[model samples]
Target: MTDTTNTDEQDPAQAEEGAIMRFMRATELDTRLLGMVAALLLIWVGFHFFGYFKNGFAAFLTPRNLWNLSVQTSSIGIMATGMVLVIVTRHIDLSVGSVLGFSAIVMGVLQVNILPEYLGLGHPLIWIIAVIAGILVGALVGSLHGFLIAYGGIPAFIVTLGGLLVWRGMAFLIARGETISPVDSTFALLGGGPYGAIGAVGSWIVGLGACAIIIFLAWRGRANRRLHGFKLRPMWAEYFMTGLACAVAIGATLLVNSYPWPKGIVRRYAAANDITVPEGGLFISHGFAIPVLILLAVGVLMTILMTRTRFGRYVFAIGGNPEAAKLAGINTEWMTVKIFALMGGLAGLSAVVASARLGSATNALGTLDELYVIAAAVIGGTSLSGGIGTIYGAILGALVMQSLQTGMVLIGFDAAMQQVVVGTVLVLAVYLDNKYRGATK
Candidate 1:
């Protein structure tokens, strides 16, 4: 009789496969992303303990501080997503901060000056109009830079560098170096104060919905692979991934719900609504803020755009090899224009968030923000060499950058020290990314 000892399972390679490798393959998780997440956790915990040792309190990991961090990350996170696309296409936009400042100043002028005159103060349509105008302005500026680069035969670096100065100058000229204040009431909600957050019930609903989507996506991916006769993950692996995603969603919901509105805000709300406060005082949950939701929505849509659209494919193709892409009949110049335009529009939206949060607009509204946005993209694993990046990675990178800054602030680091730390982290991220690429190759 033929020996049927299942020798294939006992091959040397199979025998030597470690548990970690098995798990990685089973889940198809990106090791680099896992490392980034692990690093983020380490940073959080390190800061928490450091604070506890110095100030006798764990300030970095508290729900209140975390919630604020999320809000602070939203604007940069939004812009960083666009920056990924730009970087993926082998380009950079040094003018993003200037564009944001210009956009915010324009929106401020509209809401506080122009629109109010036309639609009357506090008109419901004023904020919407102002936002639309801001986005358009940003897009226009981006398109101009793109035009100069693609058709005008100017290099992207010079064009955008000029734009950085030009847009800021324009913003100053328009606002006359003056600060604009008291934006429309409804528009201010996008900045994410206590009232700007969705309550506990809404947060729970969002979390559960997210879980449902995660499960559905996993199921659909599996089905597609089965239909194509592609290699499939083990059933246990599938379950594990789904459960892990669900757990994260639920955990985030719980964290947001754990943060309560300030006592003063709660008291004011109770008095306004004529509700009696219990002896223990009110504990109104300040669930996910509007800006956070906006960031999430942007992440989802950008992910879809990158992974499920022809434009995204073209972008990667161009980044992989510009000459080949051009030879393949891709309209490289037009694509460049569109990409910059999108980046500009995103910068404008970020401006809306930033100005709204501060309830004002100034020439310096987004000063030095471009550095953080670019750092976030680079840190999130976008290859500076081009053609490799992810929207989710950029967003996570933004969070990481924000966390670092926030932790330093909480630990009493001065502005100069913070910049030093950020610069060092960015260099380290790039170095690690290079090493990772070499190893994978």
Candidate 2:
């Protein structure tokens, strides 16, 4: 007994190992995000070759393709941001597609059919009212779902599943199995169509503005942390991250600006106007579609909500442990209601964007969209078990998934193979997450 030694403290290797473990634990989330970036790069490179060699074209990496990807990703990206919140609270909304479809149908009917027929409201006024009304419809539907689940004591899965069928049936009845066309031009401007494009100059200006804001925020945050005596990342690390963010902003702007107007379209427009081509004018296509801006706006707001607000922390806490949360005086039911309502609202926004992009609304508007929205969030590293996700990562996940779809089509892969690959990737991603999560624990 007198000879007992403190082997734990005496072992030099133990200190080094403990330090390494601490660093690993601190960096796990950052590591996962970096891995996602690397995976996206790999996917892009693989698809670039597949499309170029297999399809005998190099369109996959062009600015035109990139711009299209951004637009296509925006719809799902918007919905996925909300889904991250939903799933983080250990809930899901299977009815988002149907909700989206019904909202768009309501807006189209009001704007194109009822408003003009009954009230004769001005075009701008009709568009404004229709948008607000559509969003309210979404919020209402979301509240209904939230109420049924929160107050009625039904499981979220069952509640939203029922909503899926009910809302989809309602959409069919509302549209009478038809499509509505020639949407209000004013409203369509939000859809990333030609009317919605933020011209090349505007895109550059916005990008620079965003970069400046990002830099300012970083500096301010670091300074605040120092003032509070909080630990900070290495100064060099902060500098590198800020530089990287700026490079990405500038790079994306340049990429979009590189795409010239399609040759046939340019010639047709020029001929229609009886205007010369200006002797070698580049005729560059517009940059940064409006939908991209919408996504960015939503993303910024969501990032702030998740990273800087008490509501976000409560949501995570509720997800991680409901009973523990209750013991700590959390009102989980009310929070769940709010979360689902928010999801519904986002679904409505996606509906507006979808309808605007197509310049019409149909009963089939958002069929299967729920799958894509959920996949985007899950693939972006949002754990299905809840309490973890990020808006930016989900947005990137949408882009990556959409890129796969676009690339597969370019390489002539059929729809079945696309589904198969997507399904496999989803399973693999979830498995990896589980393994990584358990190891960290």
Candidate 3:
């Protein structure tokens, strides 16, 4: 009883300070972000070493190429974003790849024979219906897995693993073990067609406008939070970072647009026996698939859901301490089910986009896609234990994976070797994650 109360209060304050210090010391710079930046730099360096470094290589980094990169990454990127949310809640979905294949088959079957005859729909209507159907089917399948894991109390790994096999078999069954090709032009355009001149201009305008709005909202949110006595990063530092990001966006737009007809290339035979080149009609890069834009929009929406919604908060809390969260009146089980359903819906959308791009449906359409999506998230620094991650981080992770694949091919690496390298990277990432968790504990 010798001033025990005073001793307790003093110890608490000291303990808080110690905890803060420990966190600051333990926190490492985001290696994934650094890795992406490094990978890009290495790509340039490799080009230089290979005697391909020139003004032309700079030209290769055109609006089209940039657009293509965005589009190419979108299908898997969307699935990966959803995976980020699931993993943050300490769950996994191996069925996404199979879900994609199954959804694609569904769409393909509808378009190829069912819808036109049954619904009497035209190409446009059929395309729209097929996409919607694929999404619904995906969601339904995801819910099944969620139910088994949540109310049924099955492990996520087991449920999704079984789902993977089931869905793949369904896809093969739907297509009768044959490939579906020559998809309608309306469907093909979603993946392979350009947005055209007006669409291109519209895209640029919308992109810039969206960037401005994001900057304003972010700044306002930070200021409001600080005014209300909420903990926040330093105001000046936040402002400086925001400004830098804006500057980079503006600079990139100008640089990409400066190239003359980079998106359109034409080769002509001259009367004098010398080949002459002329700029063809303006066109965007093959990477700018419509599905890419769809994926990006979905990513943004999911990010808002995870960071700004109550459900998202519950997800983190449950992952961190389910028992404590349940004690606090959180519906942990329900939330987990909803999240899995959401992930399934995303998987369905990804499959549609990918299939539309390829202009065909096949059982092998989504083969090993899970590996890429999971690798992207892991490399992007999502905690395996859950309760910590970001959409931006996942997207960066996808970029890194895609870049590595694209670069390796450009450098003439064989398919088998590429697989081995990717597999190695994935193992290393898991090992690092385990090490980090051990240290933190």
Judging by lDDT against the true structure, name the best candidate: 1
* Model 2 worst lDDT run, 10 consecutive residues: 20-29
| lDDT tens readout by residue for model 3, 286-355 | 2224665676678788888888999878888887888888999998778878888888888888877788
Best by TM-score: 1
lDDT of candidate 3? 0.73
Q: Can you list the residue pairs that collide in candidate 1? A: none
Judge candidate 1 at residue 177 and give its lDDT: 99
lDDT of 1 by residue, 314-430 (tens): 999999999999999999999999999999999999999999999999989898898899999999999878999999999999999999999999998999999899899989988
Residue 6 deviation, candidate 3, in Å?
Answer: 18
Question: What TM-score would every model get versus the actual structure?
Answer: 0.97, 0.91, 0.81
Candidate 1 regions exceeding 4 Å error are 1-12
lDDT (0-100) at residue 413 of candidate 3?
Answer: 70
- Give lDDT tens digits, candidate 2, residues 282-354: 4755688888898999999998898889888888888788888878898888888888888999888888889
